[model samples]
Target: MKLAGLTIAYWCVLVMALVPMGCAWLAKAGQLGKPRRQGGFDNHNPRAWLARQTDWRARANAAQDNTFEALPFFIGAVVIAHQLGAVQMRVDVLAFLFVVLRLLYVMMYVADLATARSAVWALALLVNIAILFV
Candidate 1:
């Protein structure tokens, strides 16, 4: 179903776009309240701050980068699918699946489950490709 004439696939694109921000928040979780000198998130030089992250924080940051890398293809696929007159319901379902898999991938990434994360990433990529052809 569409909200304001935007299909679920389009909504999924918006959600996917925001996923990187959520990953960034996760990367900086728990350190935002302290002073910058005490290892808090640095609004100034944020890239340096994020680059200094380690462990799961680093993983979350990496996930953020990967999510950003994935976004353009997903966006293009949805747009092309719509322009190609692909079935809306199939596209929406695939897009939703892609989102779910990507979210799962992020969780697995943060949890340090490399094998599962890679698997989920592959699945989400396949889902995005399916959206292009649906």
Candidate 2:
């Protein structure tokens, strides 16, 4: 089925906007906080301990930047596709993959799996490239 440029743009916007929301959810849920430690640890609370274990705030900030990082490419892809007179099905398919893969990337990042997340990120990058060339 054919998809509209406006529709794809809206979907991209929605996906990008959700990244920070997920991060905020994690922080609010205490998932981003410190982890529990055995005796002899300096920090008492798990949150504080986890904070010392890793710079989660920095990670979250990076995720935010990643989301923003996607914006230009996403917008450029749509604009290029529209200008190049690409088929709606082709554009839609790329758009769908880009959005889904990005969401998965964000989730994997939050979970701290670098290898798999990088693969997903690469896939999304390829999709963007495809859109630009198509």
**Segments in model 1 whose C-alpha atoms lie over 4 Å from true places:** none
| Alpha-carbon lDDT, every model | 0.95, 0.69
lDDT per residue for candidate 1 within 1-134, as digits (tens), equals: 79988999999999999999999999999998989999999998899999999999999999999999999999999999999999999999999999999999999999999999999999999999999988
- Over 43-126, each residue of candidate 2 has an lDDT whose tens digit, in order, gives 345345334434554455456568778878877887788788888678877878888898888777777788998999999999
Look at candidate 2 and tell me the lDDT of residue 71: 72
| Candidate 2 colliding pairs | 34-47, 34-50, 35-50
Model 2, residue 119: displacement in angstroms? 0.8
Q: State every prediction's TM-score relative to the real structure.
A: 0.97, 0.68
lDDT of 2 at 79: 78
Clashes of each: 0, 3
Candidate 2 segments exceeding 4 Å error: 1-5, 28-58
